[model samples]
Target chain A: MIGLYIVTGVALVISFAFDRKKTWAGLKKGWMKFYKTLPSYLFLLMLISFILLLSEDFIIENLGQENIFLGLLFSLGIGSVTMMPGFIAYPLSRILLARGVPYMIIAAFVTSLMLVGVVTYPLEKSYMGKKATILRNIMSFLVAAGISLIAGLFYGELV
Target chain B: MKKSTRNYLLFSAFLIFSFISWLVQYDFGLAIWDNFLVFARDMVLILPPAFILIGLFDVWAKNETIEKHFGKTNNPMRFIYSILLASTTVGGTFVAFPVANALYHKGAKYSSIFTYVTAASLFMIPMTIMEASILGLKFTSIRLLASIPFIVIGAIVLEKYFEKTAYTLPRVDQK
Candidate 1:
């Protein structure tokens, strides 16, 4: 990310000397596109929060006092299907973790949170190559699930 | 009816699905204390407008224009700008996809678009905070760091492999 910042900055500086008009045009296009999306994003967040509210029962029941592996599996499944924002899930996760859910599942679930979810899938299909998107998602879910299991076991031993 | 109403009906269906899930398991029914849980769940979701906007952006943008900026070239400027753009754009990895598609149609290179999606989806601060809150800071740090290689390798490998697939898919301009 740092590398990108420096490189982009240099580009901007160079652009000013050679072609300010082109640079301004790109920035304006990007900014207009970005600002226009804000309201919609807020609405999306609200909708996600609502979806999580419906699944409160699932979280409270399945998320408590389980082996780490099961938790990981559950999280992965939910992550693949659900569209709730990570912010709402974070608090729910905290609640579950304190209740004795295995760290493995929690880890996997957290990983799944950002990487995989059905809600955003249509959009993904639109922007990315369909095959690539599906394959990447499958790989991510599997990796997330496995990483959680290993991390959970290690944490169990250490703590 | 209206889009909102349509979405509401769809949501009701999903709610019913959850209820069926509870019936099958029975263990997941609403506990007495946290009755408000269901309401709270509804607050965080992807809205119809957002979805529409994503689609519109995909449909409206020119392919060649986006490609010129983000295409698989090694210009340091394009690479840096693309990375920063990916990092700050907020949404699920999937939401970012439509943008990538829009960019692709506008002629963004396959490699840079892939990289942008990879970064946008995985490297967001929101994700980091969520992990830290749930498991602990150390765990969060480890997972975040670990994902870096996956993003890089995954984007590069898939970008090349998926190039033809994009051309095959329905373009917004065609419609």
Candidate 2:
């Protein structure tokens, strides 16, 4: 996150140096875009928090507690629907992996958590168009599943 | 309803629910509040600069330039370049989506945009390092390697599928 700020800061300085008027306009445009999208983000945050609270136990238990197929399905479903920042999701997956959970389930959860965002699909559609948003999510879901299956096989020793 | 008002209503509804939960059970309310605050703080940490960079990208990069680089072509170089650019980007999926949309509006190919979106989420440096440290090098390596071909293939298929979709609105054309 600090890296993002530093890069943004430097880019702003360069933008200003190159063209003051354009830079100001760009900043205004940025704020407008940010503001325009802020509501969706806030709504998602609220929904995610509530979902997180409700699923705290459910996720911990069902993500890896069943047959491989069911566990994979559960992980993919939960991860797809839930919106979590990478920071939180990665560490949580790590903990799950350390706890003797199937790596396939952990992989599915982490991959889907990053790639598929059902919770934010509307927000994504606002930008990418409805068809494109749905297509992207479907592709990501399949790719995430593929990644998990491959990881499961290649890293079988870990499991 | 106005967009702002609609959003405000949604937020207030959630707030009311939280308050009622608090009245019914203190810990539930506190937990909800804590989760919201954590997300809010992370958003504060990331959104400002991410959006600013996006704004700068809009101001500086030209539509023709984007098209020239990422527009429909069978050129393998474009694929490599698109993946590299998106993979190294700092923010997660949400932050990358608008930038990819901007590129799309600028006439970049849908496949390239899809590739960028997937790569941005999957191959971020900070996230990769974190995953490696936590999940072990073997798991991280295998997953990363497995994902590349799928991302490439998915990008091409999506591009072909969405080829008819028109570019919506260019930022520079936004008045």
Candidate 3:
């Protein structure tokens, strides 16, 4: 996060130096964009919080080491709704792996955790419109499921 | 409906839901509240820089530059470059949207935009390292390798489908 700040700061400085008017216009655009999306994003976060409050325990308990079907469904639900950061998600999945959770389930959770965003669907809709956003998300879900199946089958006994 | 009105309706729904959850259980309400605040903090921390970068790119990157780099009619290098650029980003897919939109505005091709979003969402250097360390190198490698062809094919398919679809997708205007 600090790195992001530093880079943006430097870029801002360079932009200002290059063209003051353009730099100001850019900053204004950035602010407007942020403001315009703030409400939808807040709503999304609230929705996610509600889902997390309901499902946090359910996920840890029900995502067993067997039953690919149930695990996939559970993981998909968990991953699609929650937008946990990579740092927390990877470690959490690692702990699940250590606890003998099915690799397939964990893989699906992790893959969809990054790729598919049910929570952020509205945000995506604004950019890509309704159809493309839905299509991309469906494709992403399939990709995540495909990766999980492959990982689970190949490393069935190994892990 | 106006976007603002829709947003407010969603926010009201959230508030009502939280109130109902609170009535059911105090702790559940508290947990939801805390999580909401945490996410709000995350947004404050992450989004400004992302938007700033997007704005800078919008202001600075010429249409010709975007086109020259990502506008190839049928070149493998365009896909590779797009994927490479996307994979280097160290943030979530939400952050990528503005940049991708900016690129689209600047005349980038749909296939390139598709590849960029796919790579950004699925793979990144830091994410890859984290995955390798947690999931082991073999699992990471397999998933990574498996994703490449799927992403490419999916992008191509979407491009073709978009051409025929009733809802016109966004396109770069010729300058």
Model 2 chain A is weakest, by summed lDDT over 10 consecutive residues, at A150-159
Candidate 1 lDDT by residue in tens digits, B1-175: 7544554566566466557756776433333112324323332233233343443444344665565567645454555566677766654463466567567656676667666766676566656666676658887776656665565565567666766554443343221
Q: Model 1, A1-159: lDDT tens per residue? A: 344345446655765677666656555544444444433333343355455556766866875533544555677887666555565667777887788776666666667766775555544554354676687677667656656655765677324
What 10-residue stretch in candidate 1 chain A is worst by lDDT?
A37-46
lDDT score, candidate 2, position A12: 82
- Give the candidate number with the greatest DockQ: 2
**Model 2 regions lying over 4 Å from their true place:** A157-159, B16-25, B164-175
* lDDT tens per residue, model 3, B1-175: 9876788898887688768878887776778887787777878888888888877887788888788888744566878988888886656677777677778777777778788888898888878888899879987897888888878877878777876764544431111
For model 1, the superposed segments whose C-alpha errors exceed 4 Å read: A1-51, A64-67, A129-132, A146-150, A153-159, B1-70, B74-83, B126-135, B164-170, B173-175
Give candidate 3 regions above 4 Å deviation: A157-159, B6-25, B166-175
List per-prediction Cα lDDT, in the order shown: 0.57, 0.80, 0.78
CA error at residue B65 for candidate 1, angstroms: 10
Error of 3 at A156 (Å): 3.8
lDDT of 2 by residue, A1-159 (tens): 666677778888888888999998778877887887888888878888988887656777677665787788889989898877666777778778777788888888988988998888756876776777888899999999999888788757335
Chain B structural similarity as TM-score, candidate 1: 0.58
Ranking by DockQ: 2, 3, 1
Q: Of 1 and 2, which scores higher on DockQ?
A: 2
Q: Between candidates 1 and 2, which one is better according to TM-score? A: 2
